[model samples]
Target: MKIRQLQFFFLAIFFVLILSGCGSSSATKEDKVIKIGATAGPYSDQVTEGIKPLLEDKGYDVEVVEYTDYVQPNLSLDQGDIDANVFQNSLYMKDFAETRGLDIIEAIKVPTAPIAIYSEKHDSIDDVEDGQSIATSNDPVNQARALAMLEDLGWIKLKEGVDPTKASEKDIAEYIKKVEIKPLEPAQLPRAMSDVDYSFVNGNFAISSGLKLNGAVYLEKTPPHYMIGVTVRESDEDAQFVKDIIEAYQSESFKKLNEEDEKYEGYVLPEWMN
Candidate 1:
């Protein structure tokens, strides 16, 4: 009788150990995987080449989800389909969140691509004829930026007291307009150059379309305008994994890759981690 009781107790203990082991295995699988989403171009390339290895070394399984459109990546992140995203800047993200009712926050400022104005009709700003049509982005923030660039170039004068953040063509006070401004979608700006006298193209679209940045008639000044960052849900703001991802992107290896990569040199800089 004593032997049988000991055997029963041992069986019960063994079953409890098996259940505990299963629970631990499930938790480990859940914690090890991290799904990151990014746009399909240079942004995705940078994360894969520059940041993935660091996370893998730290025992995290990093999976990069590639996207083409700007909207889907954030949507995926918000829905918990992705761990995080690194495509847009704070301005774009703010606009997206307000317009879409999202609760995302920036994780780190990575790099900024200078916006440029390209022209097939004119080699330089001096060559642009008075009354010629110049194309700019129609998106509100970018449109304001395009106008600011023009204002800086002495092409037009914005109204006094008009905040740079809230600038619009309607804000132009002077009637001495010599150029016809046409606003178009950011993607279409590059292709519209042949149709218009000049078109302002964002860096990503310009580079992807093979537009040369070096000889552009106008380019956004570097530094502050160069602020682009990774984004995550407000809940993940202080997560250790988020911090690790930021550190990895800001690593020396990644910085070197951004600085020395042939395609990256004139196109982007290594200004990671704000």
Candidate 2:
């Protein structure tokens, strides 16, 4: 009876030690894991090429999560599925979080690819003809951006004293080219190049579809607000990983990668990098 009791005592101690060790290991692994979210194209490449290696060097196990749509990355971050995201501009982030009741914030701006006018039917802006058609984003914010570009190109004229950020098709005071402006889904805008005389393609979608930046007929002068950044939950805004991400983005290595790579050509760089 004494021997059996001692054996049971030893077995209990062993199990406790094993369980405690496993718990510590699990905690350490969890601490080292960092999941970043980005869209399927250049943004994801930014994570895979620019951010991931830097975090890995700091002993983190980085995972780049690719999202197909604009909303899911923010939703996943709010739900704790991803640690950070690098897809949307600060203005878009603010609007999204405000409307959806998600507590999120932008960490820092990354190199952003500007939206540009693309065409399969025309080679240059000079080729634009009156009464032709142009497809652009249907979303109010992006549509406003496209309209602003058209105005700059002397293809249209917006109303006096109109807020450029909020300007829409209705704000166009004059059609300098008399072209029909068709607003379509952003993803479909690339394909619309086939059907319309021209389409304004968002940078990410254009790059994903193998359209080069140099192929654009006219690129927008991307404003700082339109620049995309790394986003995180509000609570995690000051976390070490978030700080590291900012540091990585502002690092010389990242700047070199962006400057030297043909893949990143024409991307509007952040102020720090400039």
Candidate 3:
């Protein structure tokens, strides 16, 4: 009987030791590293130069994983390879998650960027000539905004009442001014500026590729839907760590970084900052 009691006591102590190990492992949530995803441009620059320092100040380790492809960031987020991603706007991400069946949600809005019309061939809009070739993004996710900006500038006209979000070159019911429309990949649009008369280069691409945002021939008004948004898994939306990250992102430090960077000049103000 005494032997049996001794054995049970040892077993109980072993289980207690195992539990203690786990408790220790789970202790101090701040020790966990937060992995953020972004593409190689101003977005990643924000995470590295701004968000990382802020979070690190709050005792959080941050790792900014940079990707060259837009698709990989979402894929990495959905597969739990990343804790969060912040490269896309609400509209683009919404369409991405729906089409790809990824259970991701945009939990916070980041700085927006105007879909700018740039031209190396032409000094200004006044210099534009009829039938000149123009380049814009071919990505379905961003094609509409590019087209919308062109329409807004009185270059083309979409069908009346047609949703700009879904608008494409096919929706061009009228050409306010005659110009050739070329749908090139977003990155290519910037470099192709020398080849095409004008191109709608994404803000980040324009900034990173050495194009001047302030010098754009035309900067369109950014729609609310076009602002960049931070995305996380819907399941992790309420997690305390996620909340901490969001708070850190919305901090004045982050806002200042966005504002100081020409790439983010107009779109870096956090919603709460207003």
Candidate 4:
């Protein structure tokens, strides 16, 4: 009887030890790291230099994973490979998530990459020749935006009742008196400027290619443009670490960085998060 009681007590203690070990391991795993995805450009570089330190001070091990393509970052987030990403805007994020059946959500609006129209052949939009070829981004959303800007500037007219978000070359039922529109990939727009009369390029890509703002005939203003933001899975939206990182990004220090960068002149700014 005495031996059996001792055996039972030892077995209970062994089970308790096992459970405690498992709980400790789980806690360690939960506190491992925070990974963020970004593309290779001002966006990624700025976050690495400006935002990473802020997050680090808040007790997060910040890792900025670099990506080249736009599609992979969201896909990685959906698969739980990354904690967050800082590349896309609300409109583009909505379109991507709906198409891919992902549950990603925006954490905060970062800044806007102004869409601009540049020309090597002409000095300004007014100087564009009749029947001149104008190249724009080939991506559906950006293509629509470029077309809308042209319409806004009175360079072209769209059919009545056409939806601006869904605008495309096919929607141009009536020809603008004398302008030939050509759609090209955003990256290729800068190069196309030498080939075509003008090309609409995103500000980031244009700056990366060493194109000067002084040379651009027209550039989009910051206020009305779609602002880019940090994104995470809907599941992690309320995670404490994620919230801390976002708070750091919206700090006054980051705002000062945006104000001082000459390249960003009137092109981008931190969103007023108040």
Give the best candidate by lDDT: 2
User: For all the candidates, what are their Cα RMSDs to the real structure?
Assistant: 4.2, 5.0, 2.9, 3.1
User: Candidate 4: global Cα-lDDT?
Assistant: 0.79
The lDDT of each candidate is: 0.80, 0.90, 0.81, 0.79
User: How big is the positional error of residue 93 in model 4, measured in Å on the Cα after superposition?
Assistant: 1.1
Taking all chains together, the TM-score of candidate 1 against the true structure is 0.83
- Rank ordering of all candidates by lDDT, starting from the highest: 2, 3, 1, 4
lDDT of 1: 0.80
TM-score of each: 0.83, 0.88, 0.88, 0.86
**What TM-score quantifies how close candidate 3 is to the native fold?**
0.88
lDDT of 4 by residue, 51-146 (tens): 888888866677899876578999999998888998776777888899999999998877655777888778788886678898987877778788
Q: Which residue runs does candidate 1 get wrong by more than 4 Å?
A: 1-27, 175-177, 223-226, 267-274
lDDT of 1 at 26: 99
> By how many angstroms RMSD does model 2 differ from the true structure?
5.0
Candidate 4 regions with alpha-carbon error over 4 angstroms: 1-32, 222-225, 270-274
Residue-by-residue lDDT tens digits, candidate 1, 1-274? 9999999999999999999999989977876788989765566778889899889999999999987556798999999999899777678789889999999998887765678888887888877667889898887878888888788888888998897655888998763558999998777888898899888887767776777678688778744543567899999899888989988977888888877776665554534432
Clashing pairs in 4: none
Clash tally, candidates in order = 0, 0, 0, 0
Model 4 residue 170 lDDT? 88
Worst 10 residues of 3 by lDDT: 262-271
